[model samples]
Every structure is written in structure tokens, then in C-alpha cells.
Target: MTAFVLIAHGSKNPKFQEIVLKVAKELENKEDVKRVYVGFLMGKPSIEDAIKKAAANDDILVIVPFFIAEGSHVVQDIRRKVEEVVGNRKKVVYAKALGDHPLIVETLYQRYLEAVRE
Candidate 1:
């Protein structure tokens, strides 16, 4: 079983949390993944707590950041924090942000095509 932990920049608004949770749920439904956990950098159930909770199972863990860029949070804050919790854990893999993927470009292209059609 592989556990996936999604790290996001937590917002104060409940809607933001809801969106993050939704994404986590969707990822959990994937056939390859066994569990999904959501963690926030500045809000409730901080990254450390989430990692600790997921670490209980001895399953392979993958951490994905929801940030749009390799900003300070992704480069320094997240790296430092993840290292602290993942100490001596060889199964942990931190994935790049969604923004770095080509899917984002594809989504933007589809949006532009839709607008042109309208």
C-alpha cells in the first residue's frame, strides 16, 4: 500500500480546505494508491502532524506539493519540514508541484479553445 500526502498552502477560508480535501479524495480513489492525506503549511493539521499520522502504517509514502511554483515555501520551508519528519525514512518521495507539469499547459489550452468557441 502506498500512502500519498498532499501538501498545500492552507487558507483561512473553509472553501479552500474543502477544495484541498476534494483533491485528496480523488487521488485516494486511484487504483494504484492505497491512501491519501492532506497537509497544510500554515493551517490546521500541519505537515508534521499529517506525516506522523501517515507514517504509522509502514507503507510507502509520496508527498506532493500543491504549490504553483518553486517559491520559498517549496524550496526552503517545505524541504526543511519534510526532512525533519522523514528522517531515516527511505520510502518517502517528494514530488514536484503541479505547475511544473505539462498538464497545466494542456488545461490552459483547452480553456482558450473553449473561450474561442464561445
Candidate 2:
């Protein structure tokens, strides 16, 4: 089975983690997604812990950065942390940061339209 892990820069506000978890829940319902986990760089259930939990049964892990762009956390920290935890035990794939996806562009346009309408 393959698991999807969403890595995010944690926030002190509880709502931040809740939103990440909500995304994970949505992913779990996707046809190809067998499992979903959320981890943070700054808070509880750190990236290491999330990967460990995901790797326990799944043979492949797809790490998706929820960051706006490929910042230091996505470019370096995420890869280093995953390596430290899994260490080639399973196939690991990295997805582009959220902002890189075309859907984000559409979302941005929609938000802009909404702002101008109000």
C-alpha cells in the first residue's frame, strides 16, 4: 500500500494543524490514496513521527509539501528528515510544493474574482 504524508510548517495556532489534518482526511478518500498522514516541522507529530507511522505498513510513501513554494524546509529539511527515518526501507516520492500545481493558479484567480466582486 502507498501512504501520503502532508508536511507543513507548524503554527502555534491550533487551527493550523486542524487544517492540515482536514486535508489529510480528504486525501484518504481519494481512489489511489490508501492512507494519509500529516506532520509538522515545528510542532507535535513531527515529520519524523508521521513518516514512521506511515512506513509501518505501507511500502511506498509519497511526501507532499503543503508549503507555498520550495523553500528550505521542502528542499532540505523534508528530504533529510525522511532519510533519517525511513533510510531506504521504502520507496519515497516527493511531490511539488502546493503553489507549483496548476490548481493553485485557478484558486488564486477565483479568490481574486471574489475580492473584486465584493
Find the candidate with the highest lDDT and give its number: 2
Which digits, one per residue and each the tens of the lDDT, describe model 1 over residues 31-90?
887777778998977999888878887467788898898889987898788789987774
Residue 54 lDDT in candidate 2:
93
True-structure RMSD, every candidate: 2.2, 1.3
Which candidate gets the maximum TM-score versus the true structure?
2
TM-score of each: 0.84, 0.91
Candidate 1 residue-wise lDDT at 57? 76
Collision pairs in model 1 = none
Mind giving the per-residue lDDT tens digits that candidate 2 earns over 21-95? 988898889898877888999997899899999999788899999999988999999999999999988999999
Shift of residue 9 alpha carbon in model 2, Å: 0.9
What lDDT score goes with residue 69 in model 2?
Answer: 95
The global Cα lDDT (0 to 1) of model 1 is: 0.84
